[model samples]
Target chain A: MHSALRFIALDWGSTRLRAYCCELTPQQELVLLAQASGPGVVKIVGTFSDVLQQVIAPFVKQYGELPIFMAGQISSSIGWFETPYLNCPVTPQAILHSVCERISGQQSLYIMSGLRYQNPSGDNDTMRGEELQLLGLLRRYPQYLHGQHLVCLPGTHCKWVLLDNGYVSWFKSAITGELFDVLLQHSILLPKPATLYTDDWATFTAGCQRALTFPNESIVHALFSVRTKQLFDAYTASNARSYLSGLLIGADVGSILHDTKVESLPTGSIILIGSGALQQAYATALTQANQQSVLITEQEVVLAGFAAVANQTLLPLSCQA
Target chain B: MHSALRFIALDWGSTRLRAYCCELTPQQELVLLAQASGPGVVKIVGTFSDVLQQVIAPFVKQYGELPIFMAGQISSSIGWFETPYLNCPVTPQAILHSVCERISGQQSLYIMSGLRYQNPSGDNDTMRGEELQLLGLLRRYPQYLHGQHLVCLPGTHCKWVLLDNGYVSWFKSAITGELFDVLLQHSILLPKPATLYTDDWATFTAGCQRALTFPNESIVHALFSVRTKQLFDAYTASNARSYLSGLLIGADVGSILHDTKVESLPTGSIILIGSGALQQAYATALTQANQQSVLITEQEVVLAGFAAVANQTLLPLSCQA
Candidate 1:
């Protein structure tokens, strides 16, 4: 195997595509060399291949014939190719083994399969990209393999995955981020904050407290309160954003705790795999709920998962299953 | 007093203004003579007088000095002239007593004051136009004067008002319509339904059922499932809109039933003051929850309320208080 640069790690999402030039070390470590991002699946309304070619042109010029390993929305129905979602409870191997491959000239592109989780209630939920991140986290840290651990991957469709002894036991998705985005752009109730205004964390925490303190009125009525608070001068335009964020995150966490099938899941601190402001908001919200969380950088886990797929480390688990 | 026509009854809200030329009968009952509507307070960024003059031009020509009784957002800060909000638990008399008036030519325009409700939890909520509608309904139906009745004015901002002995005891607002509107226009998850397609009431009832059945995952997560159902072919693009509407309305009703202070409040059938399809949707949702409801036209209540204000019939209650 060529050791210097073996694979291209790509996290193609609905609205954006992120790529990283990666190498495999002698000690079986994935090293990220160069990174690039551009228009996501949503932007490429025409041909996915053409957009992919344009987006990864720089990486291809630097390292030729390096097979691309991809995950996320790129593998779903709307992406470059449609791959079947593997049903849970699935191990890392089940994910790696289900990769669908396509060839562009001499380059080999492998897309990781998505996951379909059926909760105890028999309702099914799907995730495309975050599954790979979970696999990568498991490969890097095997401590989570013994006991049942829960991970909250917060985003546009935040995923709450329950990992039990190296298997994805069950998962649920919260549409908080997407709802928040639409509300921010469209709702007449919430005023548009100034460009220079930073998030008011105190207001956010207060919102989180409200969510925890008042569970019944948390989702529906509390959202309206964002507007009422602004109208009543209790919250300024700048602080409304943070307050909205806190309310959403707090409600999601509260739902996961109260509503889900596995309410009594023996997980201590939730493993939150996300980055930037959104993740921090969730972490703060969890803290307000008296719940502890450990944050993991999204990119690191995604790249590692792609590396794990490339090296076929997950094959043995699938074979065992 | 002139018996033929006394005043123009204006129900000015955030997005639209509905006006009715009303007359006081020999028995002191209100009779709506003619009606007109135009862009609401939100659309009138210019001088409200210009828009008002344009809309009621025909009425103005006929009834030269007939007074105009206005209620709703017209009396808000952003409306023609701001009126102070009356404190709850308040009778229709208090609302009438707080009317702010302005003289346009020989015409006296009276704008009804809003209502402010502060709960035991110390959270404050306000209502403008719905308060007038409630007062109008109370004037028309005196049965509510002796018992605790619940009135739901379903609209962009759905007002769930609790009326106890002719006073607005406690009320809550849900931004369901506004959320649904934004999601329809802005969110990528839901595909636009066919314009010519009629509403699938069965699918809507199914959505309501889902909301009632899945109480835990109903509000936040169920919204996202509208997208997944379409993606997985569980629901088509045509039915997605109805399903989304059901989910929103169902969750809203569920939230009201579960979370509010009047969770234990006993009432046979809710008094739903609304019109058209939105009212039908709420009624269907309420029926799904095994709750009965009585429908009342919003216009009748508003006009009656305005006439009551103009004739000073509500003064007796204020004097008694």
Candidate 2:
């Protein structure tokens, strides 16, 4: 069992820290043995080392001093140690070579470097944790490594990564999630009595269709439609909430489709990485835009990412079998 | 003096109320006798009548029960009287004829109707207060009454009204100002310590240029660039704030330019109604978009709007001279 154990993976972000005790089978498949979570870097009351120990205590107690791999904001400027972002057109091997290893007491901890891309237009965009997921995607589906693909990871700041022949060529980021949150909480677009959002796919699809219909219009206009629709169309608070989500997600998807000329690309070439409601919304939006997309759960990708990195850097030669 | 005095014009909105005491000269010119302001409809603690009486006390005491004409949120469903919106393509005469009158004790009050437009695509947009301003524009510059014109009113909700041959053809409202306020106050893009915004024209121009360059991309993506520029390019909080304003304003202007094909229209055909920093920012954005605009102050337009409506509805035939 100890021989089967590989490394502990930590997905630490702004709000939460998720720890996965991972193992590699003889067939080289990654498996999650145990998992734990706690407050993220921003929410930590005590020292990061102390919080880290507390979070991984049970796993450490079971498997003594396994190598720990950390991703996300854990390597941000405010994290335990700041790691430099690797410039884009980066490959998985290039990312593996750039890992910053630190000795924390008796534990060997490795922090993954993020990716930064400066487009031909000289606009700069940076992502910390999603690089590992992209790398994991490459590992899981080597077929993607040989082709040009658009990989979308939806979150607070949704990222659209362009992969060209095994390299991360460039990417764009959208503030869709954060804008939706701020608008829902602070703007007049928010319905009174703050209705909790429920799944209303029809309303959501309508919003997506509205956004798609006006591909050239600023989203600020569509956002105001959320208010006008409620006033003139008798949209309830729940319907408005669902519709708002769809408008934002649809705009995000539509921007990529318009900017990248996704209609000209082969169908199902766009890969979406997210889970649950956001994934469903993006899928619906893509469908509304007449674009096909392949969906992958975020958890699957992140764990596979950690395992792929661990296999390259931590797993012994004997484990290669 | 009382004989020369005309109706009092109230420009009451969500935040504040301003009352303009006016007189029509024998030469048919509108003269401002005095002006006063107080909390708007949303901030009124007491009855609308009490607030109105208090705000217009000096004028009423001086002139002895002059007819009062009110516009803005004061006539909305949430305001003192729920005045229905006049549908487009409506004329100023139609608006005056639709005025809803309510007698408050000894005082007679007339509430001006708002405008609601449904485009050919069946999208709805509504505007209060600005309808009067649009009427004022026609009154102040009768030349605008004969041709196609785009009138922009930049405020919390920026309004774009299309006037065709003396009728308010249709209009579109962008939540640009409200979005900037909400984003600056609540989003991750907000610079720390909450920097007070000052004039940073260079930074603002950069943002406008960026937005105009990406006319096909969603503003959501450009919004994320605000954070990225701060992270990678070392932008100050003030710079970020100014840049954000430009981005929103630019996107708003770009949408109209693209949608209306403004380049095909006569130059300087767009009339901008606003004042202060917002007016300057919008002017700059319009200039950046290569579209010329004529400027009008909010005070001038609202007063003219109220005076125009009053001249039609409240002024007796004896005062027509």
Candidate 3:
């Protein structure tokens, strides 16, 4: 039996650290061998190195001294080590070339730097973790390589990336998920229900439709409708949760597609990278907005991106490498 | 010496109660004799009647069994006594006719029912205390009765009412202030500054200008720019608060003005009923939106409204007939 090619990959974000032990298969796919997760960057009580060492202890014990790679906010300013943001119009190769390397005792570690875009008016926006997901998407399906495409990775900060000729041409970030969370917890509208509403597509679609139909700058007014709808008995408190989600997601999608810089892009076949419920919601919203979208699991994209960067570390060293 | 005409008027709302003791002069002007304030309906630990009695004890002693008038959320379902909503398109006379009365021993109390608007599509929105403010505006300045005037009362629930043909033809509420509060307290953006920035009109107006220029539903997108702006050092933590405020307020004004129904209304000289810092902020936003506005103090409006409603109670009534 051919010994499995092994490596350790971490998807470390603001609030959680997910460690993955993976093996490269003969079919050129990265397969997860074992996985563990601990507190994210914010929750770590001790130095990041200490917590990281503890998290990967099992993986290292099982497979001695495997090369490890970290992505996302772990490489951000608040992370274990600060990796500078790479200016956008970056290709997958450029992203790979920007990885920062460090030695922690016996461990070899690589971290992917985030992407920053300076707008025409000189405003800067940065994205660190999502770049790995984008790189993974491009590598997994090279078909998206040749043309301009919209890639939306929905999370706390939903990223709307324009992939022009296989490079991150420009992107915008929407605080959709974070806003939703804050509103649900702190705002008067949509108080947490006695029991979570599992699936309420009717109100969700209605919310999505409202966002799509309303004039683009009227979101503040539209949001108040969530409360009025509940007060009028049009929606129960339970279902209002889904409605709130839909309104936020729908607004994000609507604004992203309607943005002037993005209006020129091809309308159909946007790639949506999200997981579970968020994925379903965005897909439903995209459909309601009359846009075609290709759904890709966030897990697969993250892993593929992590594996690509890990595999790069194994390449033969050159004098100018 | 002639004894001053005496009555008790309370502007009782969700969080606080402002009670005013006023006398009607021989000149037919209502003058402020004395005033006091205490816990509003939501904060009252004991029965509202008990609280009211305590609040007006000195007034009752000075003038025996004075008629009391209350307006705002204190008359709503959650307040001392539940008063049903009076439908809009209501005149000052209609508002006076809708006051619900109660008697505690020798003390007689009158509470104004809030205004409720049911859209053609059957959504119900109710406004309590603001009706008094709107009424105060009309009674205070009868000239506004002649034509369509946009009366914007900026506060926790900002009310944008159309005073058409001497009546409240229609109105809409935007959760601008409440949203701003929740966002400041709960969201990652705009953490409360250790020291207030005091004034940041440059960034504030930039935010307002952004709202005016962007499409109406793009507010969700513009809001995120608050964070990105800070991330890039474009704004300090202190100034960002104003920017966030501008974004919300500007979006509100933009959407209210841009709505198809009110788009036909004359745009100049909006009646902006607010007080203090909020009034200044809304005025700034309105100017950026290319509209002229006249500022009216909320204190005068609420007090005048209470006095107006109280005047109605005295007419056609005699000690024994």
Candidate 4:
């Protein structure tokens, strides 16, 4: 039987810290054992070593001197050490150099490198923890990404990446969800529903279509139509929520997808990495914009991604040789 | 001089107020005398009579038992009382009924009626003070309204109205200026400019074009480009300001006039209202959207509108009969 071995991985983001313990069976099935998390490395102010020691103390107490892998903002400019942003066209070796080094530790540790790419416009894009998930998803479903694929990782600034040949070729970020919050709460035409998202969400979906179809239509006007329609007794406040939702989603999709050659992207084949409201909103937009669909949850992808990075750490001959 | 004018017509809106003192000179100029505004009728709160008593007391003291002509939100539902929304396809008589009979003490008051029209799809539209202004502008520049004239009233919600046959037909409002404020301040794009609008604001005008030309582009993506462009040394703060300005104004124009086929409204002619910032912004949009242009300030046209409404209050014997 192949050696029953354990692996551990850590993900530290702008606002989170997580550590997990896992093992690969002789049959190569990955199983999670224990996991722990604390406030992110960036959020806590202290010596980098102290942060690392404090966070790992719980796991260390149970499993002494374990192999561990780390990724995320802990490797950013203000984190443990300034791991300078890796420029485009970086290799695995170059990426290794981009990881944080020099920590006085008693056990084994491997740091994952962020991915970077240069666009034809000489622009650059990079990612760390989430990129690992893409690799894992690709490894598991290789054929799904062989052709140019559109992968959307939705969040604060939702990143939409186009993967060509297993590498991130180009990507754009849209603050669609963020803007929705502002427009809904802060803007003048805030159509705050007396109620939350209701059953008649189709009105919102239709508003999205209006926005998408007519990129130049006055969203303000469309927005006030929610009020006037309600006032004039043609629409209800319940409908207001959907109208506002549709307007925002429609506007976002219309504006973003307008420049793209819409026919080129295969419908219903999108890869989405998001959770909660953002995922649903993006899915709605994708359905509207491409008449196709993409729905990939961030939680699932993030865990799988952490595992994939851990899988790389097992090849010690490459990193420590 | 004859009776030295027993009354003045006060037309108050989002910005300034116009008081058309109704008296006669050898050459009738409907002399517009004094104007002092603490707050508009829509802005002040209290009993309708108290607000009117306090606001008009000063003006009433100056002109004594002066007949007053009122309109706009003064007749709105939340105002003194419910001057029910007459809706669109409204006639001059419908407006008189929409006004409160006792708007100003015992003095007879007549509030001008706004224009309301329902589109073929049953979509409704209305305008407040602009109708009177259009009435006056047409009275003065009749030909201007007949041959495809587009009048723009810049405010919190900018209105673009198309006038023909001495009637205010259809209008659309754009929240361009307000969007600029939110996008510039609250958005993740950039902090508000250290200063107010610059004297040379070509950048803002250019922004309008971008909005008009690329209405369907993801505003969030467009926003990121602003920062990235700034970071990569491609855009200066001025350019950033310009891009934002262009974006909003462009969006306004794009929303109002993109491929929209109405029955031949002249592109070059535009009427602008509001104070300086709005004036400049309107000028910029007109220049870009029309390629050829002329801007008629609200000051010039609004007074004419006030005068027109004042003259109409006399009521020809033919109508009374």
lDDT of each residue in A1-321, candidate 1, tens digit only: 333336778899877789888887757777787888877776675687777777778877988756788888888766777788899999988887888787866666888889997656556788999999998898778798778888999877888888989899888888888888788867766754434557899888877888777766637677877876776756877688788878888888877788545578764999999999888999988888788999999987887788878777433433565
User: What does candidate 3's lDDT look like per residue over B102-158, in tens digits?
Assistant: 876776788888888876756567788998888888888989879888888887678
TM-score of every prediction relative to native: 0.90, 0.87, 0.89, 0.74
- The alpha-carbon root-mean-square deviation between model 1 and the true structure, to one decimal in Å, is 4.5
**Clashes within 3 Å, all models in order:** 1, 0, 10, 24
Candidate 1, residues B185-210, lDDT tens digits: the string is 77766653434546778778877788
Q: Which of the numbered candidates is closest to the native, going by highest TM-score?
A: 1
What tens-digit string does per-residue lDDT give for candidate 4 at A175-254?
Answer: 66556556655554534343465535677676777677666565655555554556564566567656776776676556
Ranked candidates (TM-score, high to low): 1, 3, 2, 4
List, for all models, the DockQ compared with the true complex: 0.52, 0.64, 0.52, 0.29
Give, for candidate 1 chain A, the lowest lDDT window spanning 10 residues: A312-321
Docking quality class, candidate 4: acceptable
- Worst lDDT run of 10 residues, candidate 3 chain A, spans A312-321
Query: Candidate 4: which stretches are off by over 4 Å?
Result: A1-141, A191-199, A213-221, A261-268, A288-290, A306-321, B1-113, B192-202, B212-220, B234-239, B263-268, B271-275, B314-321
DockQ of candidate 1 (2 decimals): 0.52
DockQ of 2: 0.64
lDDT of 2 by residue, A56-95 (tens): 9999899877889999878875578889999988887897
